[model samples]
Target: MSKTILEDAIQEELSFFLQAIHECVHTDFNCNRVLNNAVANIISSVVSGKRFEYTDPLFVKFMKCLDENIRNIGTANVLNVLPIVRYLPGDLFKFKQTLRNISMIDKEIIRPFIEDNRNNYDDSNVTNFTSAYIKAIQQRRQEGQNTNMSDGNLETCLRDLFIAGSETTATVLRWGLVYFLNYPDVQEKCFQEILENVGQSRRPSMKDKTSLPYVEATVTEILRCADIIPSSLPHSVPHDVEFRGYTFPEGITVLPMLSSALHDPDLWGDPRNFRPDRFLDTEGKFQKMNEHIPFSLGHRACLGEALARMELFLFTTSMIQEFEFRPVDGVSPSLQGLPGIVYRPQQFNMKAIPRAK
Candidate 1:
């Protein structure tokens, strides 16, 4: 049953991906359009009680929305970091106002159901996460159980999931592209490996990963070098713990230095260089390293990791197979990433020459 559900979810997500790709390649796809489309798609899927599929329009819109929202939120976060902008009296107010507006929109969308459930909650329309959560609350209420679920909690969870999942993945992709442009040899080697292993007729699938060592290595290297999220979300140590004779007090905030792990010399030889071969064994099989923790490790690791990996594999392979990325004219691609809650490549232009079939 669990496998079935997981498969269904994967199918649904793929449907949305297809739609977004269609828009990305054919339409005048901008950041906003992509984001709005993805949002609409996710909402529709939840409402319709259908499993996500790659061909679904909702999936397409969801991907677009996901992409655009990342770009917007990333920009806003960077601007907010400026000492002058941080001090601007109006900026905080504006941010709060914008957040309130978002909350209002969310409330309005779910209001009708809330009112209907004030006395007796309905389950028919509970397809998405919000509705599912509401239904769970209602079911507990019907059973005469004390339910502590609140609108505030629900809204916060939903907002975080949407924002984090979207922005982090998009930011990673942006950095990956920048790295590819900076190191064309690495990109070419990756493309060749993918073509030789996966073939050109059908798109590369997750199962093909084991057989495509070079491609997998390149992806790992990209994540390691990108280090999009340098400081992971704060994690509590739970109880007092000792590491290397140093005692860490209980309840103290522990910031997992993700970049340090990624760049650890013990695990990676010449950790500073962009070397995909580091992840490949003598037999040309993909090797997993303990230091590669971009999605992080332990219980609080990213929930959307599987989905993100699929996206990275497909999108990167597809784009590189189709285009030869080079630094535009005299302008060199910036290796220095713009720091934010998420690190991103500074706005850089690249010339993409379409590859001949």
Candidate 2:
């Protein structure tokens, strides 16, 4: 798709999200409405073979469940360590229970489809990822391969993909907006670059990203400063592995601290500041840095990296090109990151003023 087309899709998706939020806000005081709207949009986009939109009903429901689960999981972590909280619980244990309920709902959504197509597969309705996987499993089974296309495994994979992709991307986008509002200079620079390089007639494209080096750099810097995933997902060492003259025993849970590496002063000069220039060389070309790995690294790196990158590039560029982000009057953008499974900007509001030309 052309850059303009992709951007239009993103704008539409955002509009849908806002509409969903507005429609449900009175009835649903919790953020679950917003979450559901976002997820539903994604689901509709994937299923309908259109650009992802967050306002779709299914997506909104899925997002609500996902958000509840994430919050519940976070609470569970706290309660596991702080026994007092668990013992005196009214809503404390309920949080973990909510996660279980969400998990059951996720399985309910995915399981029936897998079971129905376990014997005979239909390729006609290959809109969602679950359907695609079902088709693949059927094909593999027909080829005499003993593939375990069980409902349990399929549900697990789908659940993981949904949670991993939706939460991470959404959190990053939230942080990007927060930063843009806080740093007007940076935001204006990005807006000017997008307008000058891509123009209003067309939306920003991945190809245009090369010409718009500063825009790309701004994104990289946002990811760097945001430090979305502070630590890599836990992994057990396969065997006795020696790294930098330190030998770690097998089966030891290893947590690679990504924040330190991304923000290391030695690796990135003055890493704390929000400097997009750090991602650019003297010649102004986008510079590749080893310290940059917002999606983690190695075999366990995110499988949705391509999709996430496309979403980020399209959404960030389009938003900046169309609107100037600034903090609401008398309100300062909160830079404090909310502690969660993925670190994200605290709740903040910004005015998206339409850009003329």
Q: Mind giving the per-residue lDDT tens digits that candidate 1 earns over 1-357?
A: 122333344345545554454444522222333323433334333332333444456456445444444445544565555635645676543444445545553554334334444445446644355566777776898899987797777766655665665566666666777778778778898889877887677666666777778877888888899898988887888899999999999999899999889988877768889888888889888889887899899899987676667656665776666666666664556888887567877776555555666
C-alpha local distance difference test of each model: 0.64, 0.69
What count of clashes does model 2 give?
A: 9
Off by over 4 Å in 2: 1-36, 47-61, 78-91, 112-128
| Candidate 2, run of 10 with poorest lDDT | 24-33
Give per-model TM-scores: 0.72, 0.82
Q: Model 2 TM-score? A: 0.82
Give candidate 1's error at residue 153 in angstroms: 3.1
lDDT of model 2 at residue 302? 78
- Rate residue 238 of model 2 by lDDT: 89
